[model samples]
Target chain A: MINSISKVINDVGLHARPAAEFVKLASGFQASIKVRNLTSASAWVDAKSIISILMLGVSKDHEVELMADGLDEELAITTLRNLIESNFK
Target chain B: MHYTLVDLLKSEHIMMAVQAADAKAAIELLTAALVESGYAEPEFSVDVWKRELAFPTGLPTQPVAIAIPHADPDHVNNSAVCIGVLATPVEFGQMGTDGSIKLLVNIVFLLAIKEREKQVAMIQQLITLIQSPALLAGLISAKDKNQVLDLIQQTLNEEHK
Candidate 1:
């Protein structure tokens, strides 16, 4: 298991499009991924569920923790962290 | 910020047994109804259909298949929701699927949100009100326009309260 902390930089935070992109990427990996908004009251939610991420209602400049566990934990955490850092580009 | 789902819906905005051929058509039918009923502008339909093509809203809600199609705020005038019940299920791509996957959708929720900030919060609220099987069953079984409104209002109030 591995985890990384990152902040949401996009203007929309994790709203519709970005949230969908993040979930799509996270769903591709075999590792179990969960995300929690550190700056908000949201608990850890399944990163694969777009509904879960959207329901978090995370706004810009919010900090989040991404955790991954299973076969490709290291790769999942690194790649997801990069995705967030790049603002889902 | 303080509006109920019923506030955005009207009988003219509801369609039963809609026979749209595909996802785009489904969105077009609903958005057109909203536009005609003064809830949105004429361009809202085209923009919504385009967005639907790109990011399908077909949610895998149980008991009855549903989708929520929305457009950019620029194309909207007033916030509105148009509901449609399909006679036969239509194929709609699921939201957030990268490669491609279709969900057989029976109900459509076409949204025209004028305020940008309200959209996310509204979707979140809708997620809570919509994920219930009993509420969805009520919506699916509604026989009249009043029944639809009552069921939606009852479920939303029950869920949010």
Candidate 2:
């Protein structure tokens, strides 16, 4: 099953530390999580990879889509959205 | 395993007057250079560019603006560096703990080896180079490819010794 959540990056852009933190959180899930910019189709990336996420160039107020598929898709989506909402707090 | 930035850049990989009118274009040009150098496939550029859109790599410099072009190591086929100097500045995300950034003129592209263990030293060296203002300015003022390469070599030499 495919589950998804969307959130805007409010704490500025996803730089090194936050990207690292986001990857760490995503890596905990059994599902395959991917993140992308909602405004652009070309922004999709592996959510569990810090380098991949850092390459996305996401800026403040940029909306992103988090999609996951696997055994724990719902939990992955919820956790990812929460992270994005909290600006990776 | 360890190569100088100039050693990483081949003549075939060098593109002068890259038609980079914007950030996306700059990325495309840099990625294309990587492919032409045999460091990656043609599709690699688009794949990395897509990833870049989700996570920006603009680094805010103490003296000036700079950007680091990076992607998942798996997206690259070989290890190398590709650089593009925008004739006109473009906005990059930011660096380190803080995300504040403005217009940046220089971009240092990184195509890392697939395994992290294989690139530890190179990555450390590059990061150190990034944080050095003297080296950064020297690179920015470099007039040509040879000068740029020399600057990188000089910095690397200082770092190693």
Candidate 1, position B138, lDDT: 80
Instruction: Encode model 2's per-residue lDDT on B1-161: one tens digit a residue.
Output: 54444455554554444556667778877887777666887777777666556555666664566666566665677777676656667766553222244456565454544544344445445667777798777765667877767777787788779
- lDDT tens readout by residue for model 1, A1-89: 98899999988899866876787788789987888889985566668655557866778899999989999989888988888889878
The docking quality of candidate 1, as DockQ, is 0.15
Q: Which regions of candidate 1 deviate over 4 angstroms?
A: A1-89, B119-121
The TM-score measured for candidate 1 stands at: 0.67
How far residue A58's Cα lies from its native spot in candidate 2, in Å, is: 23
Best by lDDT: 1
Estimated TM-score for each candidate: 0.67, 0.61
| Candidate 1: Cα lDDT at A7 | 91
B1-161, model 1: which lDDT tens digit per residue?
A: 64556667778988887898888778778888877877788888888777666556777888987888776666787887788988788988776553178889888887777754445456666777668888778877778778888888888777766
Quantify all predictions' global Cα lDDT against the true fold.
0.77, 0.65
